[model samples]
Target: MIRSILLTAATGLLLSACAQPPLRGTGDLGVVIERASGSVQIIESDSHTALARLEGLGDLSHASVVYSRDQRYAYVFGRDGGLSKIDLLSQRIDRRVIQGGNSIGGAISQDGKLIAVSNYVPGGVKVFDARTLRQVADIPATPLADGSKRSRVVGLVDAPGQRFVFSLFDTGEIWSADFSQGASPKITRFNNIGQQPYDALITPDGRYYMAGLFGEDGMAQLDLWHPERGVKRVLGDYGRGQEKLPVYKMPHLEGWAVADNQAFVPAVGRHQVLVMDARTWRQTAAIAVAGQPVFVTSRPDGRQVWVNFAYPDNDRVQVIDTETHAVVADLRPGPAVLHMEFTARGDQLWLSLRDGDQVQVWDPYSLKPVSTLPAAAPSGIFFSSRAQKTGY
Candidate 1:
C-alpha cells in the first residue's frame, strides 16, 4: 500500500508540473486605451478576460504595444511620448519609462534584447534594454547635409548576425545596424529604396530583408549579408491605372504574411495581398481582399492569413488560405479592426477593434467568434508568451 501511494503521489506531482503555465512575453499583453482619457486596459491573453484597467494615463493617442521576448512585460508608447511598462502576469503597470516626444513606432529586436522607438517631435530614436526596461542608447537622427526634412525612424526589423534595419521617412532609406557588440548601435545608411520604404520584414531564415514601398505600388528587397549594394524593386504598377483603379497608397504596405518561403504582402490601395516568392523575390500572384486591408497576420502553422481593414463598408477581418491564396472565411468582429494576432498554438486569433471598445476572439480555422474582450480603444492585439502558458 505504501509503494502504491508513493507512485500515485509521484504521478500526481508530474501531472501538476505539466499543468503549470509558461513565462510572459515582451509583446503579449492586449492593450486598449480610452481615446479621450488615455485610460489603459489590459487583458491577460490566457484567460481571454480583462486583467486590469489602469486610469489617469492622460490621453495616450494611438499607443503602440510591443511585448518582451518572454511576454512577462509589455512596453507601450503613446503619441505624446508616454511610455509605460506593464507586467502581464501580475496585471500591473510596472513603470512609465519616459514622457514627452512624438513617439510614433516601436519594435523589439529579433533576439528580444533591445527595443527602439521613434521620436518624431523631438527627432531621433530611443533604444531600451529589453530585459530591465532601461534606457541604454539614444541615436540622434540628424537631417542629411542636403537640407532635407528630418527623417523619422518609423519601422524596424532585426536580421541575422545580430544586425538591425530601420526605415527612414524623409530620406527614404533603410539604415542598418549591429547591436550585438557595439556600445551604441552603429547606423550605416544603405542605398535608397524607392520613394518611401515605410516598413520592412526579415525572412524567417534571415537571408533577405524586404521593405514596403509607400510612394509607389511596389516593394524593395535587399540581401541581408551585402547591405551596401542596395535594394532592388520587387513589385510595382500592377497594371492598376490601365487595367483597373489605383489600388495602393502611401505607407500602407503594413501587413506581411509569410508561409513556406513565400511572403504575402498586402498592397492595401490595391486591395490584394501580393504573393511573392521569397527566394527570387518574384510576384507569384495576388489574392483579392475586401476594402482597405489594414493588417495581415497569420497562425503559427502559416496555413491561414488574416486581413483586417476598414472600408468599402464597415471594418472586418478575412481569413485566406496560404496554399490556395483565396478568401476562406470572413469574420466581422467589430468596427475599425486595425490589427490581429494569433496565439502561439495557432488555435485562436485576437482582434483589436478600435470602435467597439473590445477585443474579439475567433477560431482562425473555423472563423467562428469565441469571445469578445472589452477594451476602450484597442488598437493592436498581441499574445504574450506568458499568456500562452495555459496552453492557449
Candidate 2:
C-alpha cells in the first residue's frame, strides 16, 4: 500500500507541474483598443478571433500602441500620459506608469531599449526604459523664442542610430535627439520648418522625414541623410487657389503612405489625397476623394493605398490605384469608422466601426466583408508586425 501511495502522489505532482496554458507564439497576435472601456482585446490574426481582453488602461481617448522588439510586449501610449507595457503571452499589463500630463504618441528605439513619448500638457518628450517603465531621459519641447510657453510636441518617430525625431506644433520646429552616446541625448533643432506642423512620417528606408503643416498649405521635409541641407518646403503652392475649408479633425501622417517610388498623403482642408514624387520631393498630382482624408494607408505590397475620411464622411473608405492615381473603389463600412489596419501579409483588412460596435474584416481587393467581431467603441487596430517596421 505504501508503494502504491508513493507512485500515485508522484503522478499527481507530475500532473500538477504540467498543468499550464497551452504554448503559443506572439507573431500572429495583435490588439484592438476598446476606447470606451479603457481596455484592449488580444486577437489572433489567423483565426480572426478575440482571445482575451486586458483592461484598466487609463484614458484611451487617443491611444496608440507599439510593440517590443521581441514582439512579446506592447507599449501603449494613452492620451492621459499613461504608459502601459502589456505582456502578450500572459495577457496582462506587466508594468505601467503615468509619465506625463498629456501625451499624443510614442516610438520604440531602433535597438528597442528605450521608449520615447511626445506630450502636449507639459510639452516635452520623455524617454523611458522599456523593461521597467522607468524614466531615463526628459527633453522638454523648446520654449518659444520669447521663452514664455513650451511648444506642444507632435509627430514623434524613432529614426536610425538610436534617435528620436519630433515636431513642435507651437514653435514651427523639428528636433532630433540622438541617444547613441549615453543617457543624455544630443539634441538638434530646426526652426521655422513650417507653421503649425501637425504630424509627420518617416520614409520606409528611414532616409526622409516629412511634417505636414496645418497653419499653411505646404509640408516641410528634412533629409535625415543631410541635416546641413535644412528643411525644404514642398507643395508650397498646394492650397493657393481654393478657399480653405474648415477642418473637422486633423489628418494623420502615421501610416506608411509611400508606394512605388511615390508618397501619398491626405490633403488638409480638402477632399483629396496628394501624390508626391519621392525622388525630388515634388507634388505629382492630387486625387480628389470622398471627403477630408484622415488616415491614408498603403498595403504591404505597396500596390494600392486605402484612405478613410473625417466626420460627415467617416463611414466611407476609398481605395486608390497607386499606378494610375485614381479612385478604384469606395466603401461605406458604417457610421463612426474610427481606424483601419491590415494584416501583416496584407491578406486581410480590419476596420473598427465604432457606431456598429464591431470590428469588420474584409477582402481589400474585392471590397467584401469577411467577418465582424464585436467590440466596445474600438478605435485603433495594431498588429505585432509593426514592431519590425521602421516608421510604424
Candidate 3:
C-alpha cells in the first residue's frame, strides 16, 4: 500500500512538471546584422535586449533581411548569393541555399508566396517559393545590343498583384515580371529609362516607382497604376553646368521619404534633400543638410524625416521637421552610423554603429539615447514589422 502511494505521488509530480507553462515571447522583436561575423542578434525592441545570437550565415558583408508575412521567418540575403530562411521563433536557420555567385538584396511577394533575389555576378533576378525556397523562375536581365548579357541587377522590389520590378545598372532599363499565374512569369520591359539606374524604390502605396540615376542629373519615375504612360524623367537638370564633386558613395533611393503628398529625395553628389510635390511631381524645396546625404528616411508616423550621411559625415545624423521643412536636431550618435530602423509604432529608433561596435536605441521624439546593446560590426538593423510592407 505504501509502495502504491509512492508511485501515485511520483506520477502526480511528473504530471505537474508537464503542466508548467512555456516561456512567453515578446512580439516586438528585431534583428541586428553582425556583418563581420556573418551572424545576427535577435533583439526585443520593447525591452531593448538581445535574446539570442545566430551564426553560420556566410559572407554577410552586404547583407539585407526581409521577414515573412507572419514575422516568424527572416529571409537573409548574403553578399555571396546565400539565401537563408531563419526561424526567428527557434533562433535557427531552418533552410538555406546558394542561389548565385553574388546577390545584392531580395524581397517577398505581397501574398507571401514568393521570394525574389537580385544578382550581380550573372546579372538577373531569381524567384523562389517563399515556403520551400525552391527556384520557380529565372528572369535573366535583357542583354544589350552588343551581346552583353551581364547587366547587374539592382533595386529589386515586390509590388502588389504578385509583380517583381527591378532595374539594370548597365542597361539603363527597368523590367517588371508578373508572377500571378505560376512559375512562368510574364515580362514587361521599359527601355531607355535613363543612364545608370543605380537604385530604385516604390512608394508605400505601390502607385509610383522611381529610380535614381547615377550617370545623369535627375531620376526616372513610372506610374505602376498606368505603365502605359512610359517612364517620365523628373527633377530635371539639378546638376547642370556645375563642376560636381566626385561621388564617394551612391545615394540610396530606398531612403526616399513620402509624407503629406510630398517626397524627400537625397540629391546625388549634393548635401541636400529635394522636396517634391507628389501631386505635380515638381521640386518644391531643397533642404540643405550636413555633408552628402545617403538616406532620407521618414518616421513611421510620417511626422519627421531622418537623414544619414556617407563617408566623412557618416558619424552624424539629422532629423528634419516635416511641417516646417527645417533641421530640428543634429545628433552625433556614434562612429559609422551605417543604418537606422524605427520600431513598428515609431516610438523608438534603433541605429547600427559599425565603428562603435554597438546598437543604440533612442527615443525619436526626445532624440535621447534609451539603451545600448553590444554588437560586433553591426551595419543593418531590421525589424519584424517590415513583414507587412512591400519593398522593405
Maximum-TM-score candidate: 2
lDDT by residue (1-392, candidate 3, tens digit) is 99999999999998987765334543587789999999999899988999899999999998999988878889999999999998777777889999999999999988898999999978899999999999988988877678756899998998988898999989999999999898798899999998888788998888888887777777788899999999999878543224266667777778888999998888777888889998887999999999788888789888899999998999999999998999999999989998888898899999999999999999999889999999999988999999988788
Which has the higher TM-score value, candidate number 2 or candidate number 3?
Answer: 2
**Whole-model lDDT for model 1 versus the true structure?**
0.67
* Cα lDDT for residue 7, candidate 2: 100
lDDT, residue 391, candidate 2: 73
TM-scores for all predictions: 0.81, 0.94, 0.92
Which portions of model 1 show Cα errors greater than 4 Å?
A: 1-37, 56-60, 131-134, 142-149, 238-254, 386-392
The CA lDDT of each predicted structure is: 0.67, 0.89, 0.88
Give the range where candidate 1 is weakest over 10 consecutive residues by summed lDDT: 383-392
Show model 3 residue runs off by greater than 4 Å: 1-26, 144-149, 238-243
Q: Give the per-residue lDDT digits (tens) of candidate 2, residues 1-392.
A: 99999999999988976764447789998999999889999988889999899999999999999999889899999999999999888888999999989999999999999999999978999999999989999998978778877899999999998999999999999999999998899999999887889888898889888888877777888999999899988877543233378788878888538888898878777898888888887888989999988898888898889999898999999999999988999898998888989998899999998888899998987889999899999999999999998877
Candidate 3 has what TM-score?
Answer: 0.92
Among all candidates shown, the one with the greatest lDDT: 2
